[model samples]
Target chain A: MRWEGRAWVFGDNVDTDQIIPGRYLRRVSYDELGRYAMTGADPEFPEKVREGDILVAGRNFGCGSSREQAVMALQQAGIACVVAESFARIFYRNALNRGLPTVEAREDPTEIVEDGERVVVDLDELVLRSESGEVPLREPPEFARRAWREGGLLELARRNPERPPWR
Target chain B: MATVVERFLSEKCGERVEAGDVAVVEPDVIMLHDGSGATALRTLRELGTERVKRPDRVVLIFDHSVPPSSVEAANRQNELLAFARRHGIERVHVDEGVCHQILVERGYARPGRVIFGGDSHTPTAGGVAALGFGFGGTDMAFTLLYGELWLRVPRTIRVHVTGDLGPGVTAKDLALTIVGELGAGYADYAVLEYTGLPERLPVGDRMCLCNLATEAGAKSAYVPPAEGPERLRPGDADETVELDASEVEPVVSVPDAVDRVRPVGDVQGEEITRVFVGSCTNGRYRDIRAFTEALDALGGPDPNVRIVVVPASRRVLLRLARDGTLERLIELGASVAPPGCGPCLGEHLGVLGDDDVCVSTANRNFPGRMGSVEADIYLASPLTAAVAAARGELADPREELPRTALERVSGS
Candidate 1:
């Protein structure tokens, strides 16, 4: 599958609070939630973000909290994909379970793709092509990619109504 | 041929499974709190379902914002009550401190069972040999509707702890030592399998280790069950680390990073403005009793230092109240907040002002964790926290305790 988006660059250790602070956790408003996405690290981030924009960052991205809302808030704001050098384990899993594509490239995407540079993400051939050059991407385990392909675990369950013990 | 985590996953999946396998398995317990319960339920409802698949397997906890801190919080709780009623989820606990504590007290967590909650510290249940981990609200919603979740089998990292702890060297200190020795990201995407004389460490102490595993980027922590519950040894470790508990000193996780730990002596006498002595990490009977006892011995804290004690659960509070321990803590100048996660996450309770420094018993000292991003949070044990509050500075508790009391651990 092919994906296209502009890169929204961030530095290392971009925590969940930075994605969306703890103060907004009690409520359930997508618009209200989207207004605060990335506000901690960049106050004008919410307004600057556009639909189908990809978030690019360094190591330990989304390094705090089990709150799935952080990923959901980004998804709501139309964050097409997140490519990081490394990700907090839970955040990586959370994004997948929510059907949001996340790629971990050995080569730091932040160095290859600059801010607002439109790049193409290829899941089929395992490559990220930008005007600068073509950077190879490591494909996640097949099961994880399958979940993403199916649009998340919830969608996967809808396909297999029998639940576990797939007899 | 399978490790403990793999075996547990296999059992839950109703078939033999291997490491590196990803499958959806319905866990025995699915816990949620006021902060995320409504979202989970709403997600399930939006999926075109009004009834939960198994209400008996779900628990709703109202500990994050108890006693109605605001109208919004109150409205959220009311909606949660209605949602819980519409469905058959009868296992609801209000003012029960934290969901992790309630998960154990309600007998929902035990050895060999897979437990999932919406909070990160849910892995605290692993201290009791249960396979507990955290998930997001959407996953919780899916689990609530179908009683299962899709999970990736995490690689196991065996942590073998040796030696007996010396004077005032508790499990909290050992955890800090391990976090410091091994970087916070050492256990990333891995499961921590703790072995070697684990029974010597009580449930509370073991929970402390598992609770802090998140800071080390661990997906989960497990202490295999000792009884009839089947035990599976970990597979060939991707990595191994050995720790000598006796060598551990009372340490602290300074502001801005959970892994950046140093001996308390290094940062001692730093004037403290506030102190908190509770959270799932160190808010059990063992911890609170230790702090209150330390206060009694030290003649309580200085009036200038702000101190708040939050019981981990309603059951813990009752246990202390029944034994006259609660009154003693109150009389000693501790402003006891209702049983819940008070002030740990920097909500309406005990928020720190700018430039303030707080010594706390909770996990993680990340920026803005307690309140202001500029304020510093020093993570320590309850005894150390009480001492800091009493002394109005970050002083080591070992210096004040009697030498006899500082003797070897009870089991050792």
Candidate 2:
């Protein structure tokens, strides 16, 4: 799916805590999760995040704690996709399983997108657009993309077992 | 040639993994955590590597956010299970217990051996007297595909603990104390060897020390094998070794100490908010007992503090019930999360609120570690953590718990 919204850029190692804190975990529902999205990093995130909003971050984007709650919090908050220089492996999988797409590319999003600047993300074409310019970004692995489209890897494997060739 | 881990670290920037001048390559067991299993399997499939190499030597765990707080999370864990089945890895332990916790109880982790895992906390296994280190998904994949993994023999730093720990103090505190002093990246690529006190420290304390070695950025950590009153003993000692554990004093330095320890308070602290107890590191019976003893001493938890305790394994949970420790914890107002990861990761039961402060016994207090980046995390010993939980503030419990509990636990 393609989405576009203002961008929120973060620095490297923006851990799961900054995305969603543990104290809020007592309430597990996604509805409550969105309220805590980036709440630690940005308290006003819930009210400010618009549908289709994209989060761009630096390296180690989801380091610390392997809680999938961070992914849920972001997706439930209406975050369309995350573009980071790198992603903690667990968080990367957690994102794909929940149908939240993440990409790893070397370019700095801070240079191209500001806190409130409009941006567009295209998963199919693997490109990001903002007022500053359009940039080519790395795409999620093929299986990951297929997984996202089919609701997750398991469903994708169930429907098209031979699709990725790896399976 | 640089080892798979070293090469990958070199290629991946930002994380900045550098190979040391001397590479130590010895691993008795290879542990894989969560999505890393799937990744390793896929890498094997792609590489068409043969034999899957000693499936018995591998241990797989699902501790990292895969216990399924939601349908999606559950599905992901299912995929991991399927992947392991396909790979023919017999040592798979999924959603059963924390990896380090189970390894020690199951006796899969032995001291003086090399150990590796895809999860960073693999170093925690060293508590059982193994050389524990963590690698990435690709490295895990490479290792499983080929029985041998390359390495950069790291300069060994030996920390000698000679003095008796005060009451309520534990290896968890020792680890936190070291990490707090060393800061997160002090030992970036070093191998830490903890020695001294075979009779003084319990097995749980050793695990806590080795577990937090990663916090100091050490590549891997170990405590020299010593003959305990148990079945385990330090293996053959090499004569060429430069450092002698016996000669060192009871001191810790980010450098001078075998494993540099950076104090949590010095690294940075913001405010007081929530406290968590559990995870593979400090989630054993001993860990829980420490917390309970502290809580009992304090009478109960403070009104404002939100304390959550998760037993490491079902066995542990049952044991606590049988011993009435569970009732006391519940009565004391400590919320007992299901025997899994609980709040260790933000996936289940309890998540942290925005801008909250969390003190936990689990390793890695990184952003969102307890659930929010805006929230600050402080790593501390179980005693510190227990006392903090009881008073609803961060306080070391060395001065709190009775001396009887401090008596070195036999058989560790």
Candidate number with greatest DockQ: 1
Give TM-score, chain B, model 1: 0.95
What is candidate 2's CAPRI-style docking category based on DockQ?
incorrect
TM-score of chain A of each: 0.90, 0.86
What digit string (tens of lDDT, one per residue) describes model 1 on residues B1-412? 5677788888898887666777678899888998778667656654556557889988999988787677777887898999888887899898867888888777888777898888777778878878887877777777777777777788888888888777777788887778788777778878887777554578888888889887787878876544443454445566678877768788898877888898898999899989898899999988888888777778888878888899898778888999998999888878888889898877767988887899999887776767676788999987778778888888776887666545533222
Candidate 2 stretches with Cα past 4 Å from truth are: A1-167, B1-27, B41-53, B198-200, B228-273, B396-412
Q: Tell me the tens digit of each residue's lDDT in model 1 across A1-167.
A: 67898888898777787787666676446446877788667778888899999998887888878777788889887798898888897787678767888888778777777888998988888888888887778878776787788787656655653463122
State interface RMSD in Å for all models: 2.6, 7.9
For TM-score, the strongest prediction is 1
Per-residue lDDT of model 2, residues B141-197, tens digit only = 656655445455454555655655543445655555655555554565566667666
Evaluate model 2 with DockQ and give the value: 0.12
Candidate 2 C-alpha lDDT tens digits along A37-113: 99867778899998888898876577554456677788888888888767765577557655688877657665677
